[model samples]
Structure formats: structure tokens, C-alpha cells
Target: MSGEPLKKAQESAAESPRALRDLIGYHLKRASAWDLHNANAALEAAGVRTVPMSVLLTITEKPGISSAEICRILRMQRANIVPVLAELEARGLFLREADPDDNRIQRLFPTAKGREEAQRMLGLISAHEERMLAGLTMAERDELRRMLAIIWREDGEG
Candidate 1:
């Protein structure tokens, strides 16, 4: 959507009970919901969703990254990340190797096709971010990202 449409949509959300705005968490939740819905739709064509794409990109960024490392980087639990790992492996997007020195540990590395898919997904995600952030100027976008990083860091999430 264009800046005008995004602005209108945000205004519509803001029209909700003003009392809700008293808490910053409400705005975060609202923005998160909006991103979740739109990002899911944006990534649907690649048979991927936001969380999985995030995992894929993370793995792509760091080859030989272990599942434990992924859990730490993404702040995911072993149980929650298990299924996602299984799905990605089953899809041939990545492969796991036993640590040479520690066979009990498994490391993740993206396959050739996985790299190809990552590029495509990155493109899609870039376009999606462009549309979603259209309402904000470049400076506002940078500040928004910095503020969000601080929020994550405060919770030891980043």
C-alpha cells in the first residue's frame, strides 16, 4: 500500500478506545498484529511464514550454527524450534551435521537451494517492509528500529 493508505489504516486503528493508548504495550501489540497479518500474506507465495523465514535467514547468516545457537539467537525454546528445524530439514532447505568433536551436537547449514530460496524470500521481505513502512520517513524508520532494538535488549532478546 501507498503512504496514504497506510496512514489511513493507522488512523483507523488509532480510532479505537483512546484509553487503550495509555499503555505502550497496546501500540506494540497492535503494530505486531498488523505486521504478522501482512507479513504472512507477503511470504505465503514462498510457502514460508515470518518466523520460519526469520529462522532461515538466521541460519543463512551463520553457517554451521547449532540448534542451541538458533534457540539462543531467536530466543526460542528447544521444543518450539524442534518442529521448525524438522520442517526445514525435511524440505531440504538445510542439513544438519554432527559436530566432529561432539557428535551429540548437531549443526545447521543451508543447502544450495536453500540459499536460492533465501534470496527470493529476502526480496519478498524487503518489498513487504517497504510497503509497511511507507508511512514513515527514513529518519523515523531508523529511529523506530533503534527504539525496537532497545526494547528487545532490555528483555535480553536481541
Candidate 2:
């Protein structure tokens, strides 16, 4: 094979299906990647990663909630959430205790430090979101959330 042909192929852009960019899945994946990158940066200052931030916030909002509920609400696996919960606990951000009514289950709650940290972290995250949605009006943002909720509802039905 001629080196010229090989070089041209190597320089070519990724070959994907036509209209890929127009697809909702493609846009969703790209938007998620961008948001994750920006969110992670803000999360780092709080001494935690994305998952831990989520866990902390959930605990703050629903104190004494069980780990099983957190897993269900986040649509995450036990194996994944276990480590994140451990990290948060180790950092003194939250605590886990055996449920009083159900001794078999463990409940999570944020400590005083956890609540303060979560408030700061949430502010940073909110700023990042505002920048990402800068082009959208308040009405548009509300409509977008409503549309996303519909998809999420269908997800549970399936």
C-alpha cells in the first residue's frame, strides 16, 4: 500500500452514521461528558468526587435514609455506592447507623460538617449549571426539565 493513501486515511475524521449529531442520544452523551468534566472540577474543591457529592446531597436532604433507597433513587449499583458511602463516612461527612425499626438495614445521615460542605459544593455545582444553560431562558429551562422527567418516567416503566 502507498504511504500517501495510508496517511490520508489516518488523518480522516471518525466515520460515524450520517445525521449522528442530530440524534438525541448523541447529543445527550456529549452534553453529559461536558457537564461531568465541569462538575468534577467543582467537586474536587469539596474533597470528594461526583458520586460522593451526590451521596452527600442525598443524605443531607433525606437524613436517616437507608442505603438501599439511595441506590434506588440514583439508579446505581450496591457495589458502586458502597465505596462512595464509605469515603463520605471516612471523611466525616456522614454517618451510617443500623435502622431502628429494621436492624438489617443501615441508614445514612449527614453530620454538621457534611451539611456545611454540601451547601458550598451545591453552590459551585449550581454555578456550573447556570453557565452551561446560559443560552436558555428560565421558561426554556423549566420546559427542558419537564421533558427530561417524561423520559425518566418512561425509563422506570420499562
Candidate 3:
């Protein structure tokens, strides 16, 4: 608590290998990997073959969102999404139907079974998110999220 020792502590803290920013980035990358692992495990437990979490998330959000929109929001190419879409469709998770309003557009929709699976997937996602945010206080978590969002936006990564 004395001035010199406190200053030395602060200096050491700043110089540590796990300084704040580096720690944050390190944990962020680790958490991303952990999320994917947990999601895959959860899917397996639910008797579902593993698929990309991105596809499951997109389908869950907009059951009938257009393929183009998925491509746009995820910043993915048609080539990347097509095979995944085909596999999901083949697995009876969803299907692409031409838009009645615009035949040129193909929209994704979860079948009845797909809807059920989506709900289960969401449960898994929620558990993973809860685990990820476990230690932070609510305010701290919110501030961290806000700060990260601002950083992303400023860097044109959002």
C-alpha cells in the first residue's frame, strides 16, 4: 500500500506478459475456440452431426432469410456457403426455396425438424455464452462488450 511499492507493482503489472490488452486478446481467441468446441460437443450430445456454428446461427435468426443476405451478413462468398447449404439441406435441416416475390432470390427455411434442432442448438449456444461470461460482473461484461464493439466499429471490422 506504500507509494514506492505500489508504483513498482503498477510497473510490474504493466510490464507483465499478460498485460491487460494482450490478456484480453488472448482470452478472446481462446474463448472463440472454446465456444466452437463446446458447440460441437453439444451438437454431438444432441445426436446432430456437426455443422458450422455460423450457419446454425444464421438459420436460427432468420428462418427464411435469403441466401444473399446470409452471404452479406457473414461477409462470406457464395462458394463457401453453397456447400454448407447443400449439406444442411441434404441433412434435412433446411431447404432453399425461390422467393415468390422474386424468383431470382432463394431463401432458407428450417423444416419442422430443423426448427426443433435450431432450438436445441440455441440452448447449446446459450450455455456456451453463459460459461464464457461467467466471471465478469454484469456491468463489467456490458462495458467489455461495448468497448469491443466500439473497437470493431472504429476498425471497420464490425
Candidate 4:
């Protein structure tokens, strides 16, 4: 085959759907892993080592948010959140109480220490998020967020 035809064939192969999806997936996964690593490092630098991402997310959002609410928002299984909640409770970072409105429900409330730690962790997380989103313009970032939300909705996650 001539060099020109070989080049054309290679170009077409690169544009194939499977190849495109693989490329997209590779970059997406890499970015996600890097973000997670950086976030963990940031949290550690802020003197937090044992807190999981879910716990941080929950605590940062509301001081006395319920565990059931966390599970629902995070789409996490109840069993998966239980051990983390137990650990956080044991550390005296938070307390769980039976909801007065519904005895079957458990409510989560951070202790004073937990609130302080959560504030520090939130600062670290904000810094990390700023770094992660540094390059994109505000409009571009908004668009990207919108697109991701669409994907999540399609997957029944939003």
C-alpha cells in the first residue's frame, strides 16, 4: 500500500467510536484518580487522616444532617456508611440520635470538635477544587458541569 493510503487508514481507525470512547474513558479515569489523590493529600495536610470523602461531604454541607440523608444524596448503601459513621462517632466527632420525629430514623449531628475539623477540611477541599478547576473559564466550567449532570441524570443518578 502507498504511504498516503496507510496514513488515511490510520486516521480513520483513530476516529472509530470504540477508539474515541477508550480515549475519553482513559482521560476521565485518570483525571478522577488524580483529583481523589490530590484531595486526600489536601485533607491530610489539613490534619485529617481517617475521614472518608462521604463523611466530609456530609459534614461540610450541614452540621446536623441525617445519615439517611447522606446515604440518599451520595447514593451509598446503608451498610457502607454504617462503619464510617461508627468510626466517626467513636472518635467523638459526631453523634447519632434517634429522630424524635421518627424513632426509626437516625439523625447525625457533629460535635464541636467535629464542626471545627469539618471547617478546616472544607477549606482544604475548596482549595483543591479551585486547583482542579483552574484552567477552565467560568462558562466552560458551567457547561462541563451541565454536561456531567446530564450524564448523571441519564444514569438515574441525578
Candidate 5:
């Protein structure tokens, strides 16, 4: 393997600087990108992208949730979630109905088909999660999840 040393050198050169690697945000972003990429690819066959998948899951879990509530809970901008919601609506994944308490607020609800698709998506998500966390022990995975929850809440509050 004459090229092995050269490949090693090239990879070493491409490694992130220590300062970047030390940053929590950098690690979070890298991990987020990796997970999102894998999830998107795995769910593509279901005609669901990452954002839509998230929206669908949230809607399924919290039926009659408003778009604003979703944005707040998910830390997504209204503008960004709008297009995703529109796409989901167009695809018959969910429907917006006027809230009984406040007609001005539109509540989100998954259609019957959407509920079925959400179940399928959950299975796909579980597979993707397993693949992503394959190297980690069960304890490690649980700890990582706990750490992430702490970070998520702290970051949102800040």
C-alpha cells in the first residue's frame, strides 16, 4: 500500500482544528448534520424530508397544536416552518383548522393517512437512530440523550 501513508497525511491535514473541536456548538452542529442527513436519506422513500418528518411527529404527538406553538417548541422560525407546513398540507399529511377557542389561531391535526405514515416514519426513525448510534453502548446512548436534552433546554432558554 504505497498510497496508505499519503492518504493518512491527507486525512490528518483535513481534521478540524482543536479550537473548533472544543466548541460545543461545533460538535452539536456536526452531529445534527450527520443525523439529519442519515434520517433524510432513510425517509426519502416515504416522501418525507427531515423538517416535514419532525413536523409530522410533533403534530402526531400533540394533535391540535398551532403552528406558532410548534415553532416555539421546536425552536424553528415561523418562516421556515411555513413552507414545511404548506408542503405537508399539500401532501395531505395534515390539515389546519380554526381553533375553537381562538378562530384567529389555526390548529394542526394529522389526517388518517398521516397517522399511518407517522407510524411508518417512527419505524424508519428507529432504524436510522440505531445506525447512527451503532458504535455506542446502550448506557452511552442514554447518557448522550440526557446530555443533549440539557443542552437543548439551556440553549433555548439562553
Candidate 6:
């Protein structure tokens, strides 16, 4: 390539606006990545990752919630949830029992240990989120969360 063409290419690349940063989707994904990294680091002491943290919180909040219900609420597939349930159960954090009304349906119940872990994880998560949004004022953070909820509040239209 000619030096002139190479120079023009580099100049254009350098001068181009960061349009991706202006995009809502781009910022959401990037922020999510940063949250994941920080949350994982903070939760490492608990031996739990983000998904498990969510699942544990859910289970603790709604005891007797079924794995299927968890799938719907978490927007996760059964295949992904099953392993997490297994891991939590093996750790004695929670247990599944056959539903009284339907023998086939298994309900999740967080044990005493699971509730304690959930409380601890929540504290860690709260700290991590506060740190992540430390630059934002309280009102801005509240508004950001409210706006984010509205974006995901409804089912997608076909």
C-alpha cells in the first residue's frame, strides 16, 4: 500500500467518533461486562458466581419456587438451570421436594445455610453495585435503574 493511503487510513480511524459508545445497547453490554467482572471478584470469597448468586437470591426470596418457575423468572433455559440447582443442592444450600399437589413437580426450598449465604451475597452485591456507580449521584442511580427496568419490562413483539 502507498504511504499516503496508509496515512489516510490511520488518520480516519483515529478521528472517527466513538459511535458505539453512544449506543444504548453498547453501553448496556459494556456496563454489564464491568458489573460481571466486579461482582465475580467480590463474590469469589463466597464460592459463588453471578448466576448462582441470582438463583440463590431467588430461591431464598421465594421458597417452594419450582425450577421451571425459576427458568421463566430468570429468562434462563432448563439445561442451564439444572446444573446450578444440582451444585447448590450438593452444597446443602437448598433442597428440592415433590410438590404435594403434583408429585411430578419439584419445589425448591432454601435451607438455613442457603439463607445465610444469600444474605451474605446480597451484602457483597450491594457493596459492589455501590462501588460501580460511585460516580453517579443517588438520584441518577435511581433513575438509571428505573429506566433500565422500563426497557426490559415487557415481552418483545413479533
Candidate 1: residue 27 Cα off by (Å): 1.0
Global fold similarity of model 6 (TM-score): 0.85
- Kindly indicate the candidate among 1 and 5 with the higher lDDT: 1
What TM-score, to 2 decimals, does candidate 5 have?
0.82
TM for candidate 2 is 0.83
The residue pairs in collision within model 4 are none
User: Residue 156: error of model 2 in Å?
Assistant: 5.8
Candidate 4 local accuracy as lDDT? Answer: 0.72
Candidate that would win on TM-score:
1
TM-score of each: 0.90, 0.83, 0.69, 0.71, 0.82, 0.85
- Candidate 4 per-residue lDDT, tens place, 19-118, comes to 5646856556756777888888888875554245458558656766787778777777878888887777777778777888888887777788777777
Candidate 2 ranges with C-alpha deviation above 4 Å: 1-17, 155-158
Give the residue spans of candidate 5 off by over 4 A. Answer: 1-14, 155-158
Over 1-158, each residue of candidate 1 has an lDDT whose tens digit, in order, gives 44677778768768888788667788899889988898889998899988788889988999999989988888888888988887788889998899999999998999998898888898988999998888788988999999988887855454
| Distance from true location, Cα of 4 in model 4, Å | 32
Number of backbone-clashing residue pairs for each candidate, in the order shown: 0, 0, 0, 0, 0, 0
lDDT per residue (tens digit) for residues 1-158 in model 6? 33554575456545646785456796677678879999999999899999998999999999999999999999999999988998889889998899999999999999999999999999999999987776667887889999898888777722
Candidate lDDT scores, in order, read 0.87, 0.81, 0.71, 0.72, 0.85, 0.87
Model 5, residue 62: distance off in Å is: 0.9
lDDT of 2 by residue, 58-128 (tens): 99999998888998888889889888887888889988789888899988889999999999899989998
**Candidate 6, RMSD to the unseen true structure:** 8.6
Candidate 1: residue 68 Cα off by (Å): 0.8
